[model samples]
Target: MDDNQEASSTKRLWGARFKSEPSAALKALSRSEPSFFRLAPYDLAGSRAHARELQRAGVLDANELAQLLACVDEVEHAFVAGDLHPIEADEDVHTFLERVLTQRLGPIGGKLRAGRSRNDQAANDLKLYLRDKARTLATAIGDVQAALVAQAEQHIDTLSTGFTHLQPAQPIVFAHHLMAHAQAIGRNVDRLIDWDRRSARSPLGAAALAGSAICRSPELSAAELGYDASCENSIDAVAARDHVCEFLFITSMLAVELSRLSEEVVLWSSRQFQWVVLDDGYCTGSSIMPQKKNPDIAELSRGKAGRLIGNLVSMLSALKSLPLAYNRDLAEDKSAAFDSIDTLSLVLPAMAGMIRTMRVDVDQLRRHAPLGFTLATEVADWLALSGVPFSEAHEITGALVKFCEAQDIELGALTPAMLAEVDARLTPEVLKHLTLEAAIGARTGQGGTAPARVAEQIARLKAVLDKQAAWAADYRGPRC
Candidate 1:
């Protein structure tokens, strides 16, 4: 069919015969062609399941089933090999695949749609597609987690300043801070895995917003397709794009987290901080300036997260006003979903590269990490232990901090005599507690930033990561 005729035919697929053509703007806005290529894998996967179901229901004899399966395989191979490109005139992947099958296998190929509607079929395809994508994304997240964990372990003994409200708060082992990020990403991976389980249902038999009258069993199709279950209701199956929304939500959250890390990279690589140095390969020089090794990749990762978040908001807005069942508005779903997936695919690997290559300047981190009287808490605790009221201890420490600031000396620089001049209760042993090592070592509580505590956390994180690796290895498509 010509492009206009093809567009008209697509409208016919809705079970209505329009007397006039669709307006050009509406046609363009409602077009599903860009999403067709992305939907092909889903179409192929669902077709495989349906072919098996047809065989089970006696709709196709064993010989005919063999021919049909072969034809499907050929189509998949051709599409993958780039010999069968999706036509712009095709309404969606479903239409394109049907057209290809009918053209290749003649009348026998037409039977593939016997008990299936685009409603259930499209839903099934999207589910299958997202299931696989989630698995792959889970792996990527795990890789990034592993990278962070490795860095944390390497820097466990490396002292750095931990900040609160953009000011140095305390001295901490750098690994302790890095491992916190690893734990956050590890949770993200778990979220994706949980979403995968929830999304692992087949919607392939909910034909045209209602259950099909055909004798075929959806359970059989679900089993063949590796879905955990068939969707319970026809209208809910076709109308529900919640799975896609959930996937996008998780991805958007992950993007936000990644952006936060990227912001740190950007700041650390700056001349003002210089605590971390990105590799020459990852760092780019400004075209106009001769002395600029810009953290462009990190900045880009941070910026791209906005796009991911925007896509999620756009999708939610699109679905908010729609009534029950499928609408042409639902065609808008793929662009947002596809954009999120594509943006994440780009971001995860780029971030992985940055993390793997970036260098942490231990000396620089140590020098500035201990600035701003970060050992003040240790001083307050010392006074509180010596029978001073906790609030009074805090005030006394603040006074000592102001005194040290006026003299251009750190709290550690104060001698026992100098400390005693400020607070008569101060002793030599109390001064020992002001040292950075003593301060950090005293905080040996569970989940503390002490070196030993960091080591313990790293060991636990390694065990969790190993279990995730095993799970990824054992995954054989979606579970039923």
Candidate 2:
């Protein structure tokens, strides 16, 4: 081919309607190859499906369909192997792939664009990409849940302080605290699964707002691409990005949960708490300090939550006040979604490893479980159970705590005379309930810190993880 022929072939997809080529500034400002090229495999998968639809519509013969499908397969393999890329003249994945196809099959490949537009193509590719990614994220979330369950099972009878407003409020089994994080993670998985249900619809046949007359059967393409159903409205199909917004929200919530767990790991590993020991592999050392180990993984996870949240906000802002059918502004969605996916990919594995390897200071937790007059609640409950009005019992318990604070003694140190002086109803029997063992055991209600209840909670969360594992394992789709 001559230089002029090669240059003409590299021109934009719709240049025939205009007298001149687009300005360099417009091309530079409108380029999306860097962000959307990753969707090449999905785009090829959609192309193959659309190829069959073309054959059904008589736009292509059986031989042309065969050739087109084969060429699409080649393009996909080259892309996956990193042998294909967009040139300086290509604007997006669609332009680059179409250019490659036209160069290979000449005019036969041009028939593939008969009933398709970049608007529907872009929407379809993102759905396919996120559908596959959601499965991966569910599995990753399960890995973190497995780490939490392992720690919880190992510490079922272990004692720890339960706090309200960051102040010691009661005694609880350590497993209960770990299971709290597991519960939050389980909800995240549920949200992801629910999000997939709405996102599984296909927009491929919507073709720039109105339904395609040439390829009148979108159901065939939808089924071929593993979508649950074809979209009900063509304009809504290409214009709506609420699915992306929902995805951002779901992932942002997951990041928020990881951040909360990370904060606790940071605090518990500090010298002030000394309740957790960081594994060397998961921790970082300071340059200047001779003795410093930092929970950098946890800190990074916490920081990345803000980034995920910003991605959600940015996508929402981009979608605001845009007209229907399709707009250039929708291009902003790719970067935000891709960034969230990338951030979670980096964070989930590190979080699972850090939790799985870190050592909990069981002895320290046990030693401090009964400090800060944590048993005062048991005394109040005892009085409430002994026919004393709860209001009166609360006052009496406050007085006992104040007296103990002045005397600089624990609840166990109070004598019968001192208890009587504080409350005439304070019999020797009240002392029996003050023990830490009794304090933890008394919480026998469902979802409580008692050993039996903690055991039940573990079993419940494990059942949830098992279902998520099965869902991820059983997922089947047209993946490249």
Please name the candidate that would achieve the greatest lDDT relative to the true structure.
2
Clashing pairs in 2: none
Pairs that collide, model 1: 228-480
Which structure among the candidates has the greatest TM-score?
Answer: 2
Local accuracy of candidate 2 as per-residue lDDT tens digits, 340-411: 999999999999999999899999999889899999999999999999999999999999999999999999
Model 2 CA deviation exceeding 4 Å by range: 1-8
Please provide TM-scores, in order, for all candidate models, with all chains considered together.
Answer: 0.93, 0.97
Q: Taking the tens digit of each residue's C-alpha lDDT, what string does model 1 give over 163-237?
A: 998799999988988888788778877887788788777787888888777634888788777777888887998
Quality of model 2 by C-alpha lDDT: 0.90
